[model samples]
Target chain A: MTETVSRCPVAHDQLPQPAPLPFVSEDPFHPPQRLGELRAEFPVSRLLYPGGEIGWLVTKYADVRALLADPVTFSSRNRQRANPIREMPEDFKEQPPKPGLFINEDPPDHGFYRKQLTGQFTVKRMKALEPRIEQIVADQLEYMAAKGPVADLVADFALPVPSLVICELLGVDYAERGSFQEWTATLLNLNSTAQQVRAAVDELDQFMLRLVKQKRAEPDDAMVSGLIEAQDGAERPLTDEEIAGIAFLLLIAGHETTANMLGLGTLTLLHHPEQLARLKADPSLVDTAVEELLRFNSIIRVGQLRVTTREVEIGGQLIPAGSSVVASNLAANRDPEKFDNPDELDITRGAVHHIAFGHGVHQCLGQQLARIEMRIGYRRLFERFPDLALAIPLADVKWRTDMAIYGLHELPVTW
Target chain B: MRVELERDRCCGAGMCVLYAPEVFDQDEEDGLVLLKIAEPPDSSLDAVRTAAGTCPNSVISIAG
Candidate 1:
């Protein structure tokens, strides 16, 4: 690499040595052990990306918050270039995100798509779905009860509860969940090859396109149908492609995140028996427990990747324009300065401040819905099966170590 | 407590509504922050502070 004089405050040679991201930890609930050390020594540590680019991993709570809050300085538009966990598809590295896939976009383009759907996910709207969510949770528990004595909770309960909720919400036929679920698993897998990811994307696109057409022909009250009928402030109604793109984004995002949280969160509680006892003893602690679980799991383990749009200082390190940065929420949530006992699972901690749903303009859109699912999902699960325990040995449980979204592959449980 | 809001900056994450529904809400059309009570009662002070502090867009501010 040439020692070129650019916007960097220091010479290229003077920059900190880049280290590969620490990927594993002995404890499933905790982030990689090295992250804590790095957060202490270098909150904005230099990182070597899988594509052989040098990036920065931001681990401090305040710095992560600041970095995400300023989306203009640290833009999401170039996320493909900054992902430290895996090499993104080369074809997509420079292309602007497909219309309606606003998570990859910066405002006002992002807000254009986001705002259209924001009303659909408002707290009030999500709260209104509580009765339906309770029914879904209850029905799933009944399904589990019938299949129990030995059940993979990931399939029998955790996955289905959110899957059914999102399916009903999006106007997708719940019967077809198997196909989308398979494709999403492949898409979110960190180890998926470029070709495999491309294939999954193509399949999902086709599926959503067909669904969008159906919704147009036979409109329903669900989100996809609502999106089709309501243009909001757009100059023209959303095109078929844009609607399909939006549906595709929501379909994958809607289920996988909350499903994983449910699976992994249940496991986390099982591991922490005392905490589980407190939650079971007092069901009212469900809200705080959900927040704490989100904090503790930090399931979006790859962190929110962004490229600096200009030279900016994060944690005192001046990152130059176009440089990649991974804001490590996993480390941020566990920052000692922010929480009294960062790693300890304390359901009463009221960890609402943790950025598990992330921070800023592009924070998780379905957060309210996810919270509702978790709160209801956990309470119902424990209430239905008070003696729930792992049917298989802890070591036998398959962790989603290969995925961008952290979760359990199969959570074998019994009452 | 007097709650100040920059509705234009509100990204509609609904943390404010979740924390203090009495003081904040999302507009029916755009889901932007809609202040229900600019000066809330003392009973809701703690919840209002949380709403201001945790709003994703930091669009909410509180003053005595």
Candidate 2:
């Protein structure tokens, strides 16, 4: 059993006015040299949501992982926007209730929605799409080469591959990926206006709703159509609204994560030419390199935030019920105790286990699909331009300076 | 060795299939490993090991 680390609960409780984010996790919030300082310094610091209200930020790997895993101890439902900064504007209430995918809901609701998605992300399903992923990567790279010498890899290739794949899976019009790309980016911006956030969610729901209607009329070889066929009962098949919720989850959760992984992952490989060479020599290294890349630079700053429903202990620290929490996936992957040389980029280091895809019940559903996409992307990109190198020094390349997604905003490269 | 699971300990994190799809499958409703192979082939031993190591919990084990 793990115990929660303690902080000034009274201080958090008394904080009527939540402070704005000084910087999002992706930025040089602190020095890259001191990436895990939040863990050692505040262990469990305070966070201000989009609203001015405060939430707890858990930094330790074990603590964050345990909190996210132990749903009985830590609750996620109705924990969306932390307690109001002052008073939530009535306008805030105008936004529709967030579609309760298993990501935010605790069981038995978590179990229910999760059940709906389980069959869809299985390895068999994902592996079937391997060739398509390879083809997608090859096509994108070909498109870039035809465009010639200097291309922004992030824009030209990395971003579109996952965007196209998710669209195809959910039965959305893949050709319209360019628009979906922008909307999704705005939604993930931590400091985006509330109206903007609400609009993004609403637009996604509408997009998904249209697909659901199309799938109902004529099924296809996609998850959306497969789901339309899955019947829970004779009369009580899932409603359109419910279908909207599930598609919304897969689309929103699946896309950027893979995009960020591919973009950031390519950057990592470029920075470490030795590792890239090792991987190119043996494509088998792609699997292990993926894990190393994930650990070296994690997915989310913290996977997801949870609130204690009852007094809970994690990693030996006890947290009071209703306290806010975040599981720091970045800190956990870098936890020296977990990896042999946690900081090293060794593609051959097969003894790796990372929480990049997360741990516990809410682990990423798109992980299998993501793995195939990344591996195929890496294989094709490296093979096509074995001389592929960053056009600019890493110091000059810009990463998203204020977002939860750690990614290169523009990965400029030339062969 | 046989791969076994403590179903109650499973939180539906699907690491098993990634490592050994031949040996593990997911429930239709939940993503928890459905134990497709009780006695995995010798060639799949490495995958089984990866599955056990990858499980967030120590829920997966190989016992003779």
Candidate 3:
């Protein structure tokens, strides 16, 4: 007889389980309340991705800043390896086929491209655009006024101003904005399927390619034309593909981020009636108010995902080499250590040091431009419609939790 | 306060000019930081300090 060994069933309940990872909050306007708990308890905690991949989610301000500043150890170049999004298609696993935009590049390459564009976004440059931006604001407000007492603030005013400004800057035809805007929306949407994203990218690439060729053929005064001229004059001219990539980046990031800020920022002010009154009473507060709003909202939820190139220690935790890390900008901006009473919206607070545009080498290139737009946008909007209020109840507002960038899907308003 | 700026280090984020326009300016060509007032008045000190502190590149400094 075969020796039958009686085996006792092991208790499944006795097995050790990993601590629950905080889900990225579906509410875009406010970060998950659990983030605060996580920040206090585990500044650097193990994050389990939807696809079962494990990575680190950095919550504290100091660690986030350190990670952003030290690019060599936490490389943005290898985002594919570090990105916790398991749904990202396999084709996107490699570096983009083209040289790609500077935001996605590392040191030398990043420096080269950034240097070329720095002049275009100077304080002086942005100030010069102020009149045009103001005009854009005025026109939008007029359009909204004509529309009625109630309107979608996003569609009527917020989206068009920046879209037109960026169009004028890039030399892209504004008439085609409807198509490109749709493409951009699809591209930035986190829920967009792989096929949908690819289709959008292909459309944008074709559009940019045609525009770049036009610039090469007849160099105009626009940024794309200026880039073409600069490259042609350089010792090594950039390829058409490279030019297209840059144009694509500018067109998409230029409009979407600022547009959201304007729409959501107005909504934020409407929420805080006292702050709105303060701003309305004193227009000069626009500068500091913009900064405060940026800090409070921090539209870019999870800033650029990075992967560790080498073994490193962060927030007293030892993360192994080749591990993925995500720095929460929302968390960092709201860190009590960084900001006084981080939750409250004080328009007077000159929170200049907030990492809303990010920090270190990859800090936002269009920040000044965005600032001017906000300062002017806010002052003009309120000045025109001092009694602006929400058309629907606050609870009825649709939040854009699906997109990579956090904002309201539609902010309806009445004045 | 005497303000000094390292123009070459300026990546043109424009915090200096934005905060203390009276003390700082930007080059038209490259948008690098340009010190307008080396020794600003006592009233401008706060603005100068804010500019130096807010500079993303840490290229601004003050002395005397």
Candidate 4:
């Protein structure tokens, strides 16, 4: 490649510069279409999104995956505010999150934040929650079976499991699921305006503020309450702001990501009835199938952003310090070079090395819990109503387009 | 099948054991995975593959 091809994609979008975004797609997730154009024409093209943000989008799997594992060269801190390729919301730009949330830190800081969460999701702790999670899955399916014939699988079953689990985890009141659900959904917006995003953040902040106050007064036993106690016993307990940020990150991340996965995953299976039947006939396949579902169509397209601390050459390109870089888990999972047949979905494909849950120092802290929830979800769902299938035609299903996370907003199904 | 653990990264989440008991047996104190077989048993390949796939650490390696 040439010098211009190697610099950031956004730099090439200046005025009077007639250049086509051959490798760039206006839609999210399908960045490959644009990437194809880029590789063929400007392999190192710059990207200046219409919103004034600019960054390089590493197109090939060799580039994105290799960069995510090497955190030292591609720093995580710079990614906290600017995700290089995507624009940062005004709310995030105005106020940086307190330092301990694992999603937004690098190395030593990342280690500290992750350590606090790591202790909570231990085998012992997750096993303890299994009975409760299984019960939740059954209750939802049972309720649906009773109301039978037709129901939206997403609202009735998929959405509740994760929401309730997060509620139980953080000790939030389940009765307020209405408001909490809204808060969880809006916080994950990828295309909403600055004012709208801030509004959502503000409401969520108020909700958390009230819960933090209640935890202080009661000091009951929950993640929040436990944190309060841990803080006291520690040589240095986290500040009130720190705890709030931690709660905010977990509550939002924990619930929405899994909930979307459950909804979209079931839909993916229902569409492929042969696979669904194969799984139902042999319940043992649920666990292996779940992994394939996660990899084949990872709900979250892009992993969290990483900033460069030093000049780094990744996938044959130089990413300077302060430049934003993101790992495309969707791309990595689908790399034809790695998997034998990358596009085909196979439930019995054995152990696939997928970065769907992510990899490296900041790998998903709650992945174990998500896996358990998914396992129980599919097992009970198929075992209980073996005939359950989609009510609407596969082509007509409404796929949410605005967000980076590709998920179905509603899944109408009937037995 | 031989079960492998990327011990460096395993956080003892115990998910492998919870999902598929036939394959993954855990150590009592440190909570690491202890395979039932030196390599994955052919009969238990399905369950073992599932257990290995769900492992968050990507530590489980099954070899016959």
TM-score of each: 0.96, 0.86, 0.91, 0.81
Residue A28 displacement (Å), model 4: 11
Docking class of 4: incorrect
Mark the regions of model 2 whose C-alpha exceeds 4 Å error after superposition.
A1-35, A38-55, A83-97, A232-236, B8-13, B27-32, B36-49, B62-64
- Tens-place lDDT per residue, model 3, A129-185, is 989999999999999999978989999888999999999999999999999999999
Candidate order by DockQ, decreasing, is 1, 3, 2, 4
Compare candidates 2 and 4 on TM-score and give the better one.
2
Calculate the i-RMS of every candidate, to one decimal place.
0.7, 2.4, 1.4, 4.4
Worst 10 residues of 1 chain A by lDDT: A1-10
Candidate 2: tens digits of C-alpha lDDT, residues B1-64: 7878897666555688777778888776556678877888889998899888788656799988
Which residue runs does candidate 1 get wrong by more than 4 Å?
Answer: A1-16, A232-234
- Angstrom error of the Cα, residue A125, model 2: value is 1.6
True contacts kept of each: 0.67, 0.40, 0.53, 0.14
How do the residues A160-230 of candidate 1 rate in per-residue lDDT, one tens digit apiece?
98899999999999999889999998898888888898899899989999998998889999999999889
Q: Which residue pairs in candidate 1 have backbone atoms (N, alpha carbon, C) closer than 3 angstroms, thus clashing? A: none
- The DockQ of each candidate is 0.82, 0.48, 0.52, 0.19
Name the lDDT value of residue A25 in candidate 4: 37
Where does model 3 sit among the CAPRI classes?
A: medium
* Off by more than 4 A, model 3: A1-28, B1-9, B36-43, B61-64
Please report the TM-score between candidate 1 and the true structure. 0.96
**Which ten contiguous residues of candidate 4 chain A have the minimum total lDDT?**
A15-24
lDDT, each prediction: 0.89, 0.72, 0.82, 0.69
Which candidate's TM-score is highest?
Answer: 1
